[model samples]
Target chain A: MKSALSTLLQQTADLRQAIRHKSHTGVTSGLVQGAMQGNVVILPADWANEFLLFCQKNPVSCPLIGVSEVGRYDMPELGHDIDMRHDIPEYYVYRDGVKVESRSDIEDIWQDDMVAFVLGCSFSFENALSQAGLTPRNVEEAVNVSMFETNIETVPAGRFFGNTVVTMRPYTPKDAIRAIQITTRFPKAHGAPLHFGSPQDIGISDLSKPDYGDAVTINDKEVPVFWACGVTPQVAIRNAKPPICITHAPGKMLVTDILDTALAVL
Target chain B: MKSALSTLLQQTADLRQAIRHKSHTGVTSGLVQGAMQGNVVILPADWANEFLLFCQKNPVSCPLIGVSEVGRYDMPELGHDIDMRHDIPEYYVYRDGVKVESRSDIEDIWQDDMVAFVLGCSFSFENALSQAGLTPRNVEEAVNVSMFETNIETVPAGRFFGNTVVTMRPYTPKDAIRAIQITTRFPKAHGAPLHFGSPQDIGISDLSKPDYGDAVTINDKEVPVFWACGVTPQVAIRNAKPPICITHAPGKMLVTDILDTALAVL
Candidate 1:
């Protein structure tokens, strides 16, 4: 008999097929149960090396999983026929580090000098946390996870330098402990939180107002647990100001064929 | 040339010598830096089988490490010449399930039908917690750990049936999470905490007043974290009401020759 995870993959393969036909283009968070979802960043050949260095410098914020050679849209390591231009839900086009356009696909924008990099996402650890009986509040609410800009600085690489972006998950002290234990197992998916209690300590001013994504409910006892977000690279990319760049829209990740457990350090 | 752990052991050996001589019959909380100190429970042969079943039933609270043969009075597996009578600096004598006396030694009460059981203590996990930068508060305050009786009852074995006794360590939500991760690695040392957060949620009425030991200061930002303590077995022993029972009194544990690292499951 097929395992439940195998069943999740069978359904995910069908969903990916729909995505391939451009009939389904949305956030892929709950689509694949056990497969790894990734944040996508595309840059020109001249800027790719520096961005790769940026990811290497700040692994917790931007854990680089697959780096495609310049002008190569094919990602054989991540999946079969995984075209960079059309596999994702949405794309954010950046010119001189400023977001210029948002599109469902990037076929026409694909450039020969462009190189694609796949980064491990916080969502990779979400499954682990849930499995450990610390289901994140955002998952229960069925919303985009609350994210914020933190005072914690990311390591600089050439022109790339900015404060990190962090995803927030509110948990009671007990659940938060379980969450920490769960997340620590996945080092590639941002090993552990930068800070947990009193968001102000990490320079987050307001709990009600988030920098990105849909906000979820925080119970009276729940404290916001902040994890280094994959969106951190977009902030760094903005600081670098490459003439032309493309990335998966925040929260709309590139769902890959890789298993989430494969990314766990232990 | 010697490793720091080896040097630390040399110092611990010195402390153990003092402990053995009844010259240092105090809490062994911080005495031997990294040695595997244990909770000692000695019972008459007629009751030893029942206590062994209790340990087997409630492995977390009473993690059985070494169980000696009846009338053996020695534990080569734990250490050379670990006499149940003289090894533990302080011993608690229970008659009809009541703690009747506290003694520095139990040589006079030693019996030919007695068997000693060495159980893993939370101190083993505390060492791991401290090394991971989540030092338990009890160790830092230099006091006997604050312990509480919980509503959560342990599985019964023979005549033994009682609720668990847990030790509390206060930490901010973040550190609590890290502590959970650190402690999970030492299942032999009570593994992960049974509960945390609101004390009343687990039938703990007041944080200030404890059932046993000293209460340490808990900052407003910190939440009390509780783990299944070594003291749980004493409560079980009290409930079992064997005509006579003996255990290492409070924090004055049996300092074994075994290394703490040797007990680490991971």
Candidate 2:
């Protein structure tokens, strides 16, 4: 008989294996219930230093969970037997600030001078939110969380500079308040939302149209709560015009063995 | 040379002394800045039991900081040499749910069977908010917080039943998020807000007019955030129709020696 913790860990490892072998190649949103998922960003050693400074300057938007050594794909700090090159369900290749290709495995393109960075994702906190009975609308609708580019600017580090990208979740004011308290506990996963209520207030002119990801229904009684999105770094990378870069595709992410509770801070 | 804590304690003691001697009859909103303040409620021993149950039923609005034993006026746990009859800056006397008189001291009316209850006030969290640079509008304007009667009802306990009262503070969405995290630390002082945004959603028809306190300015970019108020219990007691009830006038609270940080949990 496996302990509950052991079973959850085993399940997470099994799911990662499926993703590693290309058996599970869809969005990783609702899979492996308690495990933490990460947004993948791989950069050449030269670009990695400036990107690290960008993350330090804008921590709320880019909470780095693990940074692999140059040329190494394994992020042992975040998971067991993790291979960043083959673990993520989907990957996107960027050349000179433009997204040029999307693929499943990055093993063929892996470079000795590249460094892998795993960032804490909002998906990790969704489980905690759902367990608190404040299930986010994106989870209920079974679609990607709505992402919008806000006028709020991110701090510049070297050439990395761009407006912030936020993920919105519609909730009633009462439920939103509880959501704020619950999410504030996970600072590594974007902490609490940057804004709530009117979309225009945050320079998001249209709730129906988003800059990235799929938009969910916003009921009449619900107000949109916006959290700083991990996609923000990608926008900065485009502005920085790094020569070569690779990242996980929009909904797909790397499943790590770390439990969601491990990301919580006081 | 006195320590900073010693000076704050002396200042609080002197202020309480002034309030006790009938020298200070106005509101206690901004005075004795670092100490905990409480809403005063006095009732006969028979009514105290039901009121206690009511406090338990609605702890957010009626956080019990201290309760005097029957016939006792001093709350030693809350402060040294505290006399409930004279500690509050001003007192309201109610007879069968109706206002009878307003007085500076209740020493003459203090009955042998009366029990004095001290409930936590939101003023304590104002210091925490101000320290975080999210100075509440009421503090900035030097006025009582804008309080309103909401449609949200409290849990019924015996005859004590009425709508929950809430205090409003206006802030930009960003500041409100920080305020929420800062105030959540002090659970005994109403924790986080009950709601934010549209006033009408919580039964408040106007932001310019409040039922209990003076309304502060709501800038074009700001949204009004509402927190459960200590006055809620007073409304409950009024509905209960206690034969003889004494309470602190709105904004005039019992200044206790306990530090504001003492109420913080996590």
Candidate 3:
């Protein structure tokens, strides 16, 4: 009989292959359950070092799970035969600062000077939360996790600086407390929530219309709990106005073979 | 030179001695800083088993730290040369579920058929919070922590049954998240909070008027964070209406030699 982990790894590998072939170009949330998914950032080598410092300075917002060698597309440490250029289901192209277009593959624009960075995503903890029966509202509603720009400032590094971006999940106080504890275990995946209750306190004027991704239902008796999000780097990158950059489209991630449980600390 | 742990232990011993001699008949909060403080409950042997079951059923609210042998006032596991009859600054006496009077010492009322229980108190985590620079509002305002009777029910065990009581501390959303992480390490100290935000959701009608203890200032941006409290068991004891029962007065806890940090789990 095949071991559960091996079966999971095989499933994840198959999913990645499907994504790479453009046969599965859609939001990757909830796909390949138990596997780790990463937020992609492809930048020129000239800009990579400063971006690395930004990640280190604001680890809660951009927890770097894997970084490819300059000009390399494969992150061996993150997965087997993972091609950064095509593994993500969808890619968002940014020129100067603004997002230009979304594509299934970035192979045409892939550069020899590009450095690929894979960041740990909150989707890892979502699996743990669902197993614990504290399914997030986004998962329950089958929509993109709500992402918003907050007034909270991120530590600046070189040209990388902007207000942090956050993902909001509405949970009742009881379940929110449990969610906090569960997510705290996955520090590399943004750790515990940054805030809960009163979105306006974080300068999120509206929860119904997020800066990125679809807003889910915030039921009565539930307070919006906010986690530092990986998309924060994209905002910083826009502020920096790098000549060119590539990132995974919101809700579409680069799936890896690493087990989500492997990210838990203590 | 004495090690820090030994020095703390010695200081705790001296503090206990002071309380035993009636030289210090006041709340034990912030006294002997790193040592543990416990909620005291003395009941006849007949009712001890039921209370034990009650603690087990609701471990978050009544985390059992030490229990004395029937007919004994000494709890060696809790402290060296401990005398439960007098170590607490003040004790509340009850008969038929009614609080009759308060006493400096229980020596005159100590019965040969009595059993002493020392349940963990939330003060154990206050030191941690303060060290993290997130001093609880009660500590800053120099008042007892605001506590309320919540509608949340605890599992009933025999005669002991009642709603859970919770202690509240107001903090900005950021600090509350950190507080949640810090307190979660000490399961014996009520672990993580039961709720944060609207008090009415948990049956707390007014933040200004707590059912027990003084209400501290809830700053404009701060939300009240609630933790399961040791006082919960006292409420249960009242509902049970045991023939005779005794407990430490609110804020007047039994100082033990155990370090507060020692109770933290990974």
Per model, the share of native interface contacts recovered reads 0.50, 0.80, 0.93
Cα displacement (angstroms), candidate 2, residue A90, comes to 1.5
Tell me the TM-score of model 1: 0.89
lDDT of 3 at B200: 84
Error of 3 at A224 (Å): 0.5
Which ranges in model 1 have alpha carbons more than 4 Å from their true place? A1-14, A130-135, A170-175, A204-209, A218-223, B1-17, B205-210, B217-222
Task: Name the 10 consecutive residues with the lowest summed lDDT in model 2 chain A.
Answer: A249-258
List the candidates' TM-scores in order: 0.89, 0.98, 0.98
lDDT for residue A252 in candidate 3, whole number 0-100:
93
Assess each model's interface with DockQ, reporting 2 decimals per model: 0.41, 0.81, 0.88
Ranking according to DockQ, highest score first: 3, 2, 1
Task: Rate residue B164 of model 3 by lDDT.
Answer: 94
Instruction: List candidate 3 segments past 4 Å from native.
Output: none
lDDT of 1 by residue, A1-266 (tens): 99876776676566667776789877777668678888999999898889989999999899988989789988889876788888887889999999999998888878889999999998998888888888778788888888898888999999999999999999876677667777888878887887777888788998778898878888886778899999998998888999988998888888887899998878
Per-residue CA lDDT of model 2 for A1-266, tens digit only, reads 88988998899889889988999998988788888888888999999999999999999989999999999998889888999888888898998999999898988889999999888889988999999998888899998888999999999999999999899999998899889999999989999999998788779999889888888998977889999988888898888888889999877988888888999985
lDDT of 2 at A203: 90
Task: Put down candidate 3 lDDT per residue, B82-190, tens digits, no spaces.
Answer: 9988899989999999999999998998999999999999999999999999998888888899989999999999999999999999989889989999999999999
lDDT of 3 by residue, A1-266 (tens): 99998998899899999998889987888888899999999999999999999999999999999999999999999999999988888898999989999888989999999999999999999999999999888888888899999999999999999999999999998898899999999999999999999888889999999998898988899999999999999999899999999999988998988989999986
